[model samples]
Target: MDHAHIITELGHANITRRMLATHYAVDSEDEQLVRHIRRLLNRGDLENWKQRVHALWVTERSGVLNDAILGDVVHDEAMEVRTHAMHLLAERKDWNKTQQNWVLLALHDDHPNVQRAAANALSLHPNENHIRPLIQVRETTPDNDPQWLYGMRLALRNQLRDEDSWHSLMGYDFSEIDAERIADVAMAIPSESAGDFLVWMASKHEVKEDSLLQFFRHAARYASREQLNNLAHLVPRKFPNKSELQLELFQSVRQGLLERGEGMSPSILNWGSQMVRQIMQKNITSGETWSYHTIDGVKNTPNPWFLQVRSSADGDRDSTFICSLPAGGESYTGILRSPIFKCPEQMSFHLAGHDGYPDNPRQKKNGLRLVDSISGQVLQEAYAPRNDTAQPYTWNLLEFTGRNVFLEIIDADEGAAYAWLALGRLKPEVIPFPELSPNEEGKRLVSAAQLAGELRLNQYIPNLKEWIVGPVPDASVSIAAAKALSRLDEANLPARLSDLLQHSGKLGTAITALRKAMIAETHTTQRALLSEMVGMLPLRYQQEVMNLLSNHATSTGWLVTQIKEGRLSPLTLRNQVAYSKMESVVSGDVKILLKEWKDSLPAPNHLLQDLIERRSEGFDFQNANLTNGRALFELACSQCHQIAGEGALIGPQLDGVASRGVARLIEDILAPSRNMDPAFQVYLITMADGEVISGMPRREQGNAFVLADASGQELTVNLSNIRTRNLVSQSLMPDNFDELFDDQQFTDLVGFLLHDSSH
Candidate 1:
């Protein structure tokens, strides 16, 4: 970090090192830093946009943007530069009058993202002057385009803090005032304006009944239960009752009942234990009355329907399919409501992201609450275990079954990390074959199985059977299923498991589990079952059978007991190392055994600790050749990481590698286990037949779990075929850099990674 070195790198031919040096220069106080890079921003060539971007980076840290540089950023030929500039502008609110017009011009920018950023910037400094241009933009914006996304609607809401302020919007066609305008648009419009808007629609506009009916459905969101009831009464009386209109009105009545926690049968709310299985069945849309609450002046409701949901059900979603967050950028500080239905024996839903803090009491940030309709008492409250993908959350409604209760999916927190609340349909029946796509549902399944067993929920016994007998359900699911059946005192479970020995594909997993749990002779039946099943393995699977026993083994003596004195059968196999068969690591009668024999081999070391001690200063980086570095990356790192767009994407792209700095990159390369990237963590999966494969987990494509190894080879494994998934501490990045390159080569590799040559 010498100032001369940082300055030199800023102007270096190696893009990576120059970027890294400029990054340091951003925080540098050397008065000459700005003078050194001013031309990079003002350079008029479109081909040199990346330099302009880097110049913007350095200047942004200086805490000033002159109009000329601002002009270059907003009107720069490259949309990338313009978008990046717009982002910087979005973060600024102190813009002068001329600067504000530039933002309004950005509102008309071609790219939606740039326009959104401009909109957000303007929304931060809402003023009456923003209205005309905003309306102009919305009028020309396509219906398919998220008109709300433009920030026009948002600025309108901010501008209209009261009904009197809504007059400017009066003459726009009623079509412009869509359902979302009624449902959300914030409390800035006032409750009275909602009524007035509806009156305007009725008296001045002759619209289709469907569009007219859409208003009631939307108003049902923020309107009170009493208001919904009032609308329910007025609809049938005032509107002519055509069949479709009558049906729509009937739907309103049901929605009103759900709002008040009245009507709806308790049985309709039931969810069975196959809930995970049911969720796995995928693509579920809840049939129950669901509503999203918009704002009421005091406690703000979200603008878009807060109660919108998407499940596996939405894969083929139309515009009508309700979604959470309206494209992940929109934030609503509100709640999505579940209808008031009589509680069935069990009720469940899928939840993902921050489950708010129940400890906050009134705020209960990001939480799900079940409340008694009449008493207004919180009957049972639960929050999702933190996750990004939907994890199944269930309520044992047995105690409250038949009672009128409703569910609330609430997000009262605005913190970026805390506001997410994604949910799926509320359901009653569990599916027979659930998907095993989620990497985090192990704990939930175990707990649910335990609860069912403790309650002797005989109804769930079938789900336990399916889970335990699956081709390759997670080991947690299998063990929990077995335990639940035993907890229910099902005498046939042992016989069923013993019979599954005939199932070489699925129960080979149970075979592995039975051996690990054999430290004590407590489960006599299972021990006998395992003793018999081990003999059932074919000779081709001898290595796998040995692995199944040795993998989880801790004590050698106890394992010997089960095979010898404990009524368990012993296996006869050839020992490859000693070239004899007396016995091995699972144990020897005496001398050479598998554990000790394996210990005799040389230990593998990648020199991670040694490099960590040496640190970034350990290598002589001055001799680095950027050309050699890129070539070396193409040979070594390109299989998983992309740089200059040439390599595979098994790991995070390294285009902005300079941003992470040299020290961080060295640690990541040599000591990846120190701080793992959750999204790119390597997972070791053991199949039921005991085949183990390791790779970086890719997104779940329905029922398939795709994993890519360091070689960039992809293995698509079905969820049902996986026995266990162990998130490995080590990364998919190859750890043999010390073996692969000498000190100079390693130094050059680091140098290349820290520079950008693309520009």
Candidate 2:
């Protein structure tokens, strides 16, 4: 194991494992060996010397190497050798001030990778004196250089005790910094001024959309109620047409207010009203009404109900008529008369009631009713059984066909009762309305059913069931309804799902519906029946069914058993399907089976290298067919990426990906994590309940973060329940396109990505 023998062995075409072990054992403690390795590293004849240096660094004992030698290697011609030397120096715990200065110097390295390694080393053993130099480096670095962003993050984290650092970081012009980094700094800094600066930037500065979104996301997690409310005021005015930004602002502000137990400001309330109006496609001004009148039995001082601003469903508060009747007032009545117009397709409003004086027991008898303006017939009535808490209600006036109507608030109780009414609007059309044509209605119903499932609104179970079993059943609508019903009441879902499978005209849609229902079904007998039914389908259809069911724990176990027992073909678990199965099952015999299947595939980089070489030699880009490329992309790539708004948005959108050049595109396809962005890094979060989730961070809401997983499903995990979160270094994008497609097919895909062609 002499140094000469080690150097010769390292230069071998493929060094044997025993030689590596021997080199690791002797190189660190042997001073003579270290000296010899250093001499070889300085020589020009030692080919693959960088590898030798890497092996030497890995084998060298911490604090054993001389400072002068380590410092010299820190400036080596090879970046990898420099990085390895810096890494070795950083491992020493006994580094004095002079040696620590070397780490600081490495932070300003010309190469981004070297700079990142130095930054990581600095984070391991940070010193207060290093903060100023790091800040200086960040200030001088060019914005376009990727290293600049890394420098900025390092500076922000190591800000130390300097109050001025916050201002200096925040004052960087938009060109010098991005919104995401600014927000990250604000979140890390425990100062009110930092949060205020973000709000001010959002309101006064012309921030780009992506950066502004990051700011809003961080604000939701860290900003105060008043600060978020202030930001909300600027949103409607500043980004009137940006629905995503508006939604984020509104949700953040509303959550902030709700958490603080406060009400929304007037400006936020107005913005919410406008959002509702826009969603309903109604003219904002057309719904305005001021004909509220009280009946003759009220006291002279004030009517029982009057127009006021109060908390409503549309945010923390909305403009609505408030009704408050005092005890022993005999009886009081309030009415809001509508302006005459043609009968609307839908009329809806929010209603909330509470005891004005909770101390009095006599306020429990109050009731509110909606009545026809001319006939005085009660359309809907809500009674307050308990007067201590606010009871909210929604009134969908689909049955009310008249042009004019009245909202009647009555109080006959001996104690005071109060109610807030808002979001009252009459729209000409609403989604999933009964009057829509069959296809449009079906699509709308599918969307509504999905929303209901997300919210876990069990009350919608009956409605969803009706959609599934209705006389004119649309396969899409029935499938969506079945899925929603399965979520709401899993125990009672198999029958309805079975009915759809037997009667539906579209076999694929029906099987999908049945598959979803089976995934959620807990009864073993029902699951067995469902599995048997799926087993009878074609192998392709069965594989698709397995893909949908693989995410469920119990269903995955069943499928694995089926595969093992020869009830299902092993070919079903191949390629992307195998990857999906491996990702879903965390632990068990199923995990072992899926992992074995995964390990049997060809090495990813080997396949990638072969493809790259083939393309480099002679791949015809001029004659590549865009249509075929699109077809291949939709089959292999669309599951994660979006192309012309037609695919799942689990990965980055490829709208202008062609402009990024074919070489860059090929590199990405071959080695996705080679230079992966931090934002796109997937997080592996283990919950306190033992459930493991992996996805990219979508947004922060209150104490939870929403993550969108590989299948485009969003999972919201509470911060408190997270046992551990590890940032995965690799990209979520799976590799091995060479195995998935032939040379011509892969070329066509590259052509599709490099041109502006649509399906």
CA error at residue 416 for candidate 1, angstroms: 44
Question: 615 in model 2: Cα distance from truth in Å?
Answer: 6.9
C-alpha RMSD of candidate 2: 23.7
Output the worst ten-in-a-row residue range by lDDT, candidate 2: 429-438
lDDT of 2 by residue, 371-412 (tens): 665676777776653432233455566667654654444544
Q: lDDT tens string, model 1, 1-759?
A: 564455455556678976786677776676576755655456653245566666676777776547787776788777767877877776775777887888889878888877777777777776667766766666655666675454667765675555455576666454534533533454334455554455344444454676655565444433444455455455544554232354444444344334433442322112222233332332222323343343222223223333343433324221121223544433445555555677778877666655444343334466678888789889877764455556667788788888887766666554444456665655763221122212123344555566566446776666665555442213445556666776575333242232233233344565554433322224566555555555555433332333233322222233344444523323322212111212322334333443453345444233456665575767555778877887688667877888877678888887877777677887787766567677887777767755456678876753567788655767567677788888756677655455567777778888888776333
Name the candidate that leads on TM-score: 2
- Cα displacement (angstroms), candidate 2, residue 95, comes to 55
Q: Local distance difference test, per candidate?
A: 0.55, 0.57
- Best model number under lDDT: 2
Pairs that collide, model 2: none
